[model samples]
Target: MDGLMPPPARPRPAFTDEELRTLVRPDRVHRSLYTDPGIFDLEMERLFGRAWIFVGHASQVPNPHDYITTRIGREPVIMTRDAKGAIHVLSNRCAHRGVSVCATDSGNTRHFKCPYHGWTYRSDGTLASLPQRRSYPHDRAEIESWMSLARAARVDEYRGFVFASLTEEGPDLETYLNGIRHSIDDLVDRAPDGEVAFVGGCSRYIIRANWKLQIDNGVDLHHATYTHVSTLDDDGRQFSRHGGGPRIMVDGKKSIDWEPFGVVGFPYGHGYQGRPPVETLPSGPVYEEYVRRLEARHGVDRTRQILNYDRFNSVIWPSMTFQAFGQHIRVVRPISVDRTEINVFPVALKGAPEAYNTGAIRSLAATHSAASMIQTDDIEVFERAQAGLQSGAHDWVLFAGHPGSEEPWHEGGWRGQGTSEFVSRIQYAENWISFLCGGNGNERG
Candidate 1:
């Protein structure tokens, strides 16, 4: 009888709103936030459900009837451009039998035909037809209405980047992106044509860690000195074909002074790190030609300002993080409490020299690809942290370094020294808590 019995299912802990608030402390967060399935479920519903999550870029679906499959939280959705040249985010599930209609990652398709039932829907989510029309004894109008795919409540775009919210209520796209819009502008302005494209496709890898780990590392300037030390060469420079990344060591031994550069946090869990204290831009004929194209469009002074490269990874919280200089955008897709999928898409600056864009695409292979030395190092740390968090040895994860040192920054943000963990602190204390509590976070901590 004992051998025939199934193992008992583990009970999931549910927390009240007040209890959720207590999980996020001033300088640390409860370890359960990283390891609990119940907390992850609540986050998927309350936080990601109402937030304006990035779907994809307009450049990805440039033509009519083109679609790309992506996710908003745990729900699978399709980002499609209809024949009328309008974009829509539709639930991937079929109205009948709850089957996923579209299975491919991306392609040009006029209709999404559910393979199992032979029910088809147009790119705009309108029901086209079904195989068993005679079998349906229901009302004609109700059948049509019920058969079509459901759409995101609201969809909007800013400078070609598309974002969708599952719930109709909440701030507009511009309001949600207020403090972080400049980073998008900074990326777009780098192109001579004032546009950027997702040309290099995507490099995706799964990490056995929580999605928040990727976000925490996005603006943390202190970890590179140790976490990725192996990637540094004899001169302490990170391996890059273009040359010039943050020099972590003086003579491959002592760490460089990080006081000059800084980290900054904005409202809604957004943040960026100031450019490394090294010359990071590429040079040579390709870069010179790229500069010439930019100068031709905006003149020398504006071109210099456009290429200033003031910041590094800019994170638009809970979903996306990108680099204007690195020419790539990283999307964080959470699978579960201890699993995440990261999609790295290399960006191509429009109207820039072909060689310049080629270099950017090639650079991604050595830095962000699944087997890249740098990214693998970070993944290892994330997995290790996840394993350690499961131990129940520690109750909290600290972000207390450089306390009270974040000064007032531009556009109602805060700036701190490069090593300051204030960025993560603000995320947990302000935006993360507010979102979990169902508020549009701009709370002062």
Candidate 2:
């Protein structure tokens, strides 16, 4: 009697179209959207499964046979460079029995051999060999075709940033990027060589909150006044390792007029905040030399435009965010309903002075790294939000700040005041629901 197996657990019913639509409204979102595991699973399927997700920078796999393993939603993937210099995003799972073939983060490996059965695949995702090949009745080509690592349905790059889609249909990478490509240009244009490399190894941290919480805070401007008040000096200026940044005082002390700086939101939940007016611009010999090199390639006027620190954190929603001026990239990886892992990679401008790149890497240590002041503060708030949303005390999470204050922005997006929540509102109202309703969720794009 003790050996009796328990009845199989019942599967939760899927959300209907109306239910999904109701979860996200124009001004607010239902609390259950954050606390429900079913919603997260659907997001991994509908949103990430169909949207163009960021894979990795092409610079990460520049050399032939170079491969880096990352995730596309819940699926493990390997971004590799073949002998022909073609980049491919291959599924990390082995074809036979679905064991992961690559375990390390990155390396130059010609073949990924499965540890379980010794089945190997080329960098291009072609099957190379397998143990006991003679046991199979099929010919070599058939076996190869069946057992090779599956490649992503589509892969493309924009300004060296690689993006992959699991489904073959939908818009191309360029079409999907919309105006966000300009933000990438802002980063690469600063590079004297017209290229940027993801240098210093990634700094990773886990947050006990829904992945959206991290992204929601990306373009948020008002949070700094209260949430990051601890990092501010007595004068209310936010201090980093290098020096002071914008001031964020909770009290009615001296504060920057952020509304004029502006925050813009684009299609597909992409957005960026205009760079807050800093206390001081980058100066000194290194910065001068950096500007001189930039001017030499492009004329003085062009260099000045390129060097203008206009955008702050450019968010490629649901996957990545980065700062062109700050010289770092943040890749968001969702682990589960209430867990997310963020990887911060410092960017090095190719052909720039070594000291400039090193300073960029060091600067991230004080702002975006795992132990950084700004990031830790944000993570705590995210966890607290997650804990609060778990209860049934509230039915909706508000995003109604500064309503009707937005203006038409470049490339058909909306620009709101610095303190507005328009970005998150559009994300939930338009894009999020479109995906959960089984569409591309790219009407605006």
Worst 10 residues of 1 by lDDT: 1-10
**lDDT (Cα, 0-100) at 60 in candidate 2:** 98
**Candidate 1: clashing pairs of residues:** none
lDDT against the true structure, each candidate = 0.86, 0.86
Clashing pairs in 2: none
| Alpha-carbon lDDT of model 2 | 0.86
RMSD of each: 5.5, 5.1
Judged by whole-model lDDT over C-alpha atoms, candidate 1 comes out at 0.86
Candidate 1 C-alpha RMSD relative to the actual structure: 5.5
Report the error of model 1 at residue 395, Å.
Answer: 0.5
Off by over 4 Å in 2: 1-13, 139-141, 250-254
lDDT by residue (295-357, candidate 1, tens digit) is 999999999999997898899987999998888999999999999999999899999988888
